[model samples]
Target: MKDAPLTPPLCSTDAVLATLPAGAGDLPGAMIVWEGALYIGTAPGAGEGGHARILRLPWPGGGAVEPVYEGPEGSAVTGFAALDGSSDAGPALYAALAAPGGGLILQAKAGAGAFAPVTEPGLGEAARRWIGPLALWGGRLVAAAGRAAPLVGAIGSAELLIEADDGSGTWAALSEPGFGDPGNVAISLLTVLDGTLLAGTVNPARGFQLWQAGEDGAWEQRIVDGAHRHVASPALTACAAGEGELLLGSGGAAPTAADLPADAQPPELLGLDPATGWELIAGEPRFTPEGFKVPAALEGPGFGWVKTARICAILRDGATITAVLAATPQSARPFGLPEPGAARIWRSEDAGETFVEAAALPHPLVAAAAFDEGLLLAGLAGGKVRLRVAT
Candidate 1:
């Protein structure tokens, strides 16, 4: 595909509207867009105890980001899901909290005072390391938990908990031995497509693979085999069924001493057909130049590579996807470091075919969500947040 000129005015960049009030020290964990508001969760920052809190930013911009729930100190929120209430249940938000002792999944209704913990029935005292990438599929809340056991080694596993309208749920393991080795991989992303739950993992031997769980609770896995023995991790998002594709961002495996002179391998973005157990449909060119270290979100026109200072976050608006590129420069060569880098917005409307420079941003963007009014809510490094609307 022919590359588009790095043009300007395809998008706009705005200033920081709200700086999340950092308690003594806090690290932003997860940010999501739901119900016309921006929800942010913070983990413990430097010198601060690990305390988890949920902050809500109302719509229409220019408002205070307040903490709705302040949990015990040292508790970290790793995942979040917005739940639409059923006949017996009311609208609520589901969150996964990772504490030092163990992890717990809690549900908080819209009007309810506080969140109530949902116990994982039949799950005994299993070790929980990280709780995240939560998904709500077919009346069940699914999440990945890294279990650390003395003899079993570290295993990345998934659990499906029955989410009843009455706030009662039951849990079952989705990663059992016979199917295949769960290995010691981390489940980075999870999504529900066409009544099936899809999970992306970074495993030891397989590099990256997409695992699917059907409505009947059966699981199947498909490895995204790349040319020249490459490692890939699947990142999934829900679009218009056929248009929705799985993104395999490159990372994890680094070149060894013997492979120094060799060129750094770029990551491949593979499109999957969800119904057929993640069948590889098409493979796009490795968007980010090789050896760039961490290649962040594939944003803008969705086609070509938008080399940024440091990729902070990626947001898609209509057919265009905007990449929040940070301005961090590196001294290392072979990584294709940006020259005179600064934070800016790069957009692509052709599905990774081409890209153009959009707008200049103040801080490094970490996360962004497209709002209904054509506005983009962006979370930046150092607890800064901004809103970028169409010019």
Candidate 2:
């Protein structure tokens, strides 16, 4: 997965920080920075409408724009994790909130001022309520609730992978809920990489699945549906680890069924290799149980178009990674959206091996950060939270 170039554009100053109209949070899922401050979290737009806040900003040196933490009306903060034991207030932080059957987790530190509720909402289960992604393994924290999607919050439909313990708000159930596959549905991403913990599901019947969790915690199931490139599950959103492998990023085609032909699958940039195998750096050219694959991007897969949806945020930065290339509301109302920007940016300075296609913007990042000079994006688009400061 390494031959393909021509895809460069990264200047960015197209910042907006907050312009989230309609009930305030058009979309801006979890991001973090802590001490020098740069929080960001907000989600709920389009039928859920908005009410999931947490914007701080003032990092590497930029200011004003506070909003703290509000969430409740239709809820949607969805994920964040830090934890460092008992909290003399330096690390701790958990947060989830997905509302509906009432899903919650909150808890903060690093000079904390607010963010409490240590879990009571759906942690016991009222159908689980969509709580996806948030990582940190054996030391606890973890997360990945379920109700899976549709009304967005959970009243039942399976999905659980819980953890928590370090600061003990007590939580368990490492798998079994949907791990037993009620057709999987929403585990979306948990990530640890390197030390390995990963869990990415979204199974719209039989596609997206990745799971991993050893060292006695059990849980395995490497890559099923997507290994077949059944691409559909928010185009397999994000996953990042690097070096030894595991840097998945498919552009979420977000269709859900309008005749579900795998929601028009088109978005790829994978490379897992090292156990269950499966490589394909671009997309389209399958045949796997771990065999054929091919495409390294000569504009193959969505990287070249067909509506570049999926890969909403990957972020790495040591050997350089940075993905994020969204486009979906069912591909902007029924077919091939690309014209006036839907969100774009793809890079890879050797970590994920290879990639290009840089900058196109208009919103669609979930979270990003990298500063020594600047590179801090927090997009959710139309629900606005846009802030791409690369200068």
Instruction: Please provide TM-scores, in order, for all candidate models, with all chains considered together.
Output: 0.70, 0.32
lDDT of 1 at 116: 63
| Tens digits of per-residue lDDT for model 2, 1-391 | 2112212445454544444334563466666666677676776655656588876767756567677788778777766777775544447777787777667878776676568767777677656666656776656666777664532332345455555545556567787876786665566667777677877776655667777778786788777886675635333566666566777865443312111232445567776865757577767776776677776544467677665556655665567766666554333455655345555676767664566766765544455544444556665445445466654
lDDT score for residue 356 of model 1: 64
Q: After the best TM-score superposition of candidate 1, give how far the Cα of residue 303 lies from its true spot, in angstroms.
A: 7.9
Local lDDT at 108 for model 1: 72
lDDT of each: 0.48, 0.62
lDDT, candidate 1, 306-335, per-residue tens = 332223344544566554443322222457
In angstroms, give how far residue 339 of model 2 lies from its true place: 33
Tell me the spans in candidate 2 whose CA falls farther than 4 Å from its real position. 1-69, 72-76, 79-179, 182-186, 189-235, 238-287, 296-311, 314-344, 347-376, 379-386, 389-391
Model 2 residue 275 CA deviation (Å) reads 29
Tell me how far candidate 1 lies from the true structure as C-alpha RMSD in angstroms.
Answer: 7.9
Return the top candidate by TM-score.
Answer: 1
